[model samples]
Target: MTDSTIWWVLAGLVVGAELLTGTFYLLMVSAGLIGAAIAAHLGVSLPFQIAVAALLGGGLSVALRFYRKAAAAKNPLSKTDGNLDVGARVMVDAWATDGTAQVKYRGANWVAMPVTGETPTPGMHQIEEVVGSRLLIKKL
Candidate 1:
């Protein structure tokens, strides 16, 4: 019946939906709804309550989106937890003219590229990252 009660109900519904769909975005909105409920209980005007809800929810959603994007950008295709080849060492006999090298690792020949900011030279290298079948190697 009270404005705060209504806001609390909305927040509860958003949380329930998030649980069913497993969508993280809804939790941001729920946080906003809870903020609005607090504002209502403080005897704030309806307009101010609405603004509080919108600002909290929208800001949180945008923040979460950007956070996810940044995290994805940082994650390479060769995940440290999933791939054992990362950090393994191999010998490079020679580097081709194109700045790539073919090295025998794990009983097979693999194409490798020098890690960024490192010069490509023939010697022992460590697998820093793996993108598909290509290996990113850095001088050890």
Candidate 2:
């Protein structure tokens, strides 16, 4: 098959794989492969086409990583985006001396603690992040 056609096919496969895996990084790589296909269509040398793919794929992945990090920094709890309990309310009956509480969340006992720079008080709290078995909670 022609070089440009091959590149386009590869890009399509990468896109399909990204869909199955649900990872954003693979989409970035697919974009790069598309760039390489364009270069091939323009009659660029094989080495130059490869360079274009590597540069676009790697550069886009790195950029996406940085962007995600920045977004997490702006909102610390953003890292827990995949957790279903995040932002869900739980009842804290009491707080212990160590600033943790035996709270009932999701119909079970959970060890809940406060987020950074907050005093743990007994009342209603929201799940901020789940680290292991412990729930980092925010007083609401």
Clashing pairs in 2: none
What TM-score does structure 1 among the candidates reach? 0.57
Question: Model 2 residue 79 lDDT?
Answer: 58
Each model's lDDT comes to 0.94, 0.92
lDDT per residue as tens, model 2, 2-108: 88999999999999999999999999999999999999999999999999999999999999999999997887745566788788999888999988899887788
* lDDT by residue (tens digit), candidate 1, 1-140: 99999999999999999999999999999999999999999999999999999999999999999999999789855457668899999999999999999999999999999989989988999998889899999999
* Top-TM-score structure, candidate number: 2
**Index of the highest-lDDT prediction:** 1
Residue pairs clashing in model 1 are none
